[model samples]
Target chain A: MEKAGWDGFEIGAMLRTFDGAIQNIATTLPEDRAYSQSSSFTASVADWRIEKPLFNKDYCIDCQFCWVFCPDMSIISRDKKMIGIDFDHCKGCGICVEVCPTNPKSLLMFPEQKDEESALVEWPKKVKKEKEDEVGEE
Target chain B: MSEIKKIKNLKEFSTSADRFEGANLLCPGCAHSIIVREVLNATNDDLILAASTGCLEVCTAVYPYTSWDASWIHIGFENGSTAVAGAEAMYKALKTKGRLKQPDRVPKFVAFGGDGATYDIGFQWISGCFERGHNMMYVCLDNEVYANTGGQRSSSTPIGASATTTPAGSVSYGEKKNKKDMVAIMAAHGAPYVAQVAPNKWKDMVAKIQKGFAAEGPVFINAMSACTTEWKFAPEDTIAISDLATDSLVFPLYEIINGTELNITYRPKNIIPVRDYLGAQGRFKHLFKKEYSYLIDEWQTRVDAKWEQLQRREEARV
Candidate 1:
């Protein structure tokens, strides 16, 4: 099941385990009230994106510089190989691009405005379609 | 020692081994991330972190999501030192009561706070903690203001710098008072270890963190962290600004041991003018304006005087 308000990182599942463990303490103790709330606070940093990284798998060295120096931890690494970036969380610091030792630079960043505009236009259409489907079912 | 040898070469420092968890939500160019990574890498032992309410705490430990691999506790803005002290006490108590059966188990305690919490709000608490001699490390990631509170002026704010509360206008020229000398205050409290460092020179900062962990009593490291958002600088200029601050002696890397010994860690070959540092950031841009240009000279004089004072103190210690 999708965790509401989270950016869909696999760590969200891990956090749920902690939420489960603290469920009793969270409910019983007033001091644990803060911990009781869902750990699903959206970092909401996607709006700050001015540039987004375009990763090229062909020239990648898998050194994980993008994963390492990223202030937002936007890059995802799996099995010792950096696979991709979580665009929703990436604040477009471009430290990854700066630190990448590759001569041609495997990771590149371009203006985020195009993606943002398309995404914004696509959202309401999807919502309207979903609404029409629900009305037809009724 | 192995860790020390590994970090000696910045290229060999692996991101995989870093204790700070990934996907942290700090501002893109925030220097605190580097500080956290370096400080955590200082000690090889299991760790416990106590963070006060600030940018690091709010952004890194956002309820369910945490950017730390170690056990972390948040006890509000002014309680970083006291909370860590309590945790240190609990660790000792557990060991004494045989609850922690491991014969060689020693977990290092680290407490973190911003300048707002450390310099002004938690001053008494931190002073008390230092006096009590807790076996913990306190790090003030001083960006020189209450940055987490939307760039408000704090006691740590430098003179002639604009902040939300100290905005430049017809009546006032940014912040009027000089930046508070929190390191001297900490040193006076007889802290076993007190050092001012910047992560721009990661090796120097890592060395201080190592020394801080090895110290017997309360140790404090004041790290100059550049905030790209609040300081009104380009994201890529974080490192550059930090280097400028160090190069200009605005944030000198120095240590005070046993409250008497003073050692300047890394001195620039030639001191750069304060304007190089100030003019690089937007906060101090107004100081260079024709009307307020005198403030630049005044600010430089203050920095030079402070640097001279440090030199005298270092010489006197010998």
Candidate 2:
């Protein structure tokens, strides 16, 4: 407590006080499970994603739907307006694209490998429900 | 009195410190993940959160590592309610002892548990919490099944949904009983506040949690948790599925004030047939078969009856 100058209130609330137990963590952790040290730099789950949501500022209505519904807090928002998707932690579930209330959705899902700029170029202005006849043509 | 700080602006709240954030192994689009964030965000004061053994506990707080930015503790499955009661009492004791310098730094006491824990396993402990008049909140992320330990049928699981334990076979139908009315049960405790909410209705959940905190005594919130893994839907369809749930009246959003007055929060523009809801998920796939189509109709009738009952309750305001 003296080193960090933490008061009794901090310790009582357990808000921001590092104790001896936390500093000297046990060396032998469970071996079967893949684990990291507590408060370690958490690894991103982006690798689990098959496709990523690409944000288009032009079409965005800033409805805040994407921000509210994002399970991962991946929808980066500023001043109540959603600006971008946090790819570092975002395991692209296409929820933002699903919840986007825009006609031509402000958020579009594209191949995970593609960049936002390139993905925006291919964004469908209006997604048409193609008849089975056209589907069979290809 | 000043209004509780509403999260009208996102930039105002610190992202990493204020609420539960990323870096856990919860599935890509679990609805409880969003619900957890909303519950945590509703409290402006510091928090001492307790999570029972379930999806929220195992996946979010792995021993010392946790996504929850608050002062979090991992408790046993049935310990959620009772544990928070102790915490709240301790806080009161600290206040008496003059340990806490700031008078308004009232840390919120909240416990979160899954359907398996909240609706069934830990219900006794939860009931005790309310009976004791503990100044705490218990939030049930009801996914309707034991999704953590591979989807088993719980009391909250809807009738006819095939679970691991209650598998649909040639002779045997799925879960034979109706989903327990957990909200009604919680309200029976005469807690100051009780409400049912879903993550799809973000504002409703936030407002309800805010009200829960504002209440004097114990508060119970039964939030619909859309478990994509067990419910057999695409991860992205979590919101749409939950929307369908409310729209179909399968899970109505309502609140019971002082454990007596009933207020229907959100009602569908046009109620969709329960068939559409039952057919959307893979768990109820067996009910769609030619031999079992009658069960769907039976379910629809029951759903209509339940909706009418709720409407009548709302009309009477009892």
Candidate 3:
């Protein structure tokens, strides 16, 4: 039996499977990051809102409600089984706080405070410049 | 002027000042207002509400200002079913334990959320609740997208519609998928009561809500809501746009009973083209062009087919 070279049928099958694998990966990947390659991330004023769920780590059963229900797809499951918020995409809508079914309410909302900086490192240059101008005026 | 009659007895129609004043967080012209009003108007019974996080939750329960008049709990988006389920369990347990004030009359429990939370995120939990036969009304404000988060597309986004994620740009077509048949899915679960009402039609909406609560088991209401922010339409046009939806037969106002019986509440006098409805909203602007026009036509055909099927069902019953 001759060892098969990269024939059209074999290559096509491989490519099809490869596409499926990519799709599976793409679906599981975070929505914000999934489109990062194609769409430029524009930082708006809404990004600054403090919408993190106040998680009482003690009561969390790791049900992953917050992670799954996050509309922005901002919550990330860390290796240690801990779920963290991707503040960049999180609108701080307190959805996590509302959904936490823990006895003491594992996730709660934190009041908007001035000191907390957003996790989104690459703030849009125009928005950043606008902020600087506002600060200068102040 | 003849069609649009002013609601008589404004004084009698006045809702409780205490209820829904601070709890609701809906924008002006939002359909959430209509739903909230309907629920509040229907029953004064001590009700436990489980609100799934979305536009409704964000606006109503933002910090201290709560528009919810009844006892409300803001649960996360997906677990509306679970949370309401939990609330029902707690309410039942309390009744049995003699802790609940009105043991004979159990507190009504209603779970409310937007399309994203209900159709997509909370589907499993909702199914669980229905399967377990929870005494609750699951109200899904079907605004068609995740309107709260800058208009991202949800499973409920109509085919050929534009959203933040499904932008109709050069790189991609509009939402290349059909809306998940949420009403059918709910009906399949053997829900005792299922209804779809447009928020613009206040009387029909109010009546359905009242009927839904009176139901024994789980009742699912897919409310066709107007999303001014997401639709990129003027806030003032919210009512007009919602009215146009039903007029165009894009969203037929109807109720389904016991998953089998079909009852269409209000059919428009003159069924307008789907284009009239689509033209009203900016989200569907791409469909007017040549390439996407065929796609829009296909979608309209699907809508017409569904409407015909519904009509046949209604006729068979008669």
Cα displacement (Å) at residue B107, model 2: 1.3
Output the TM-score of candidate 1.
0.79
True contacts kept of each: 0.18, 0.35, 0.00
Candidate 3, residue A116: how far the Cα is off, in Å:
44
Which structure among the candidates has the greatest TM-score? 2
The local lDDT score (0 to 100) that residue A57 gets in candidate 3 is 55
Q: How many backbone clashes are present in model 3?
A: 20
Runs off by more than 4 Å, candidate 1: A1-48, A54-69, A74-89, A96-108, A112-138, B1-6
The sequence of per-residue lDDT tens digits that candidate 2 reaches over residues B138-171 is: 9999999999999999999988899999999898
Best by lDDT: 2
Look at candidate 3 and tell me the lDDT of residue A127: 28
Model 1 score (lDDT) = 0.75
Give each prediction's DockQ, rounded to 2 decimals.
0.10, 0.22, 0.01
Considering the two chains of model 2, state its CAPRI-style docking category. Answer: incorrect
Give the Cα error of residue A126 in candidate 3, in Å: 51
True-contact fraction in model 1 equals 0.18
Write model 1 residue lDDT over B1-318, tens digit each, in one string: 112323554434443344554446687878888788778766567778889889998887775566655567887899988998999998888888889865474778999999999999998999899889999899999998888879999999999889999998777789998888999989988888999988767778878888888788999899998888878987755666777889888888899998999999999998889888888888887877789988888878988898898899999993
Model 3 TM-score (B-chain only): 0.91
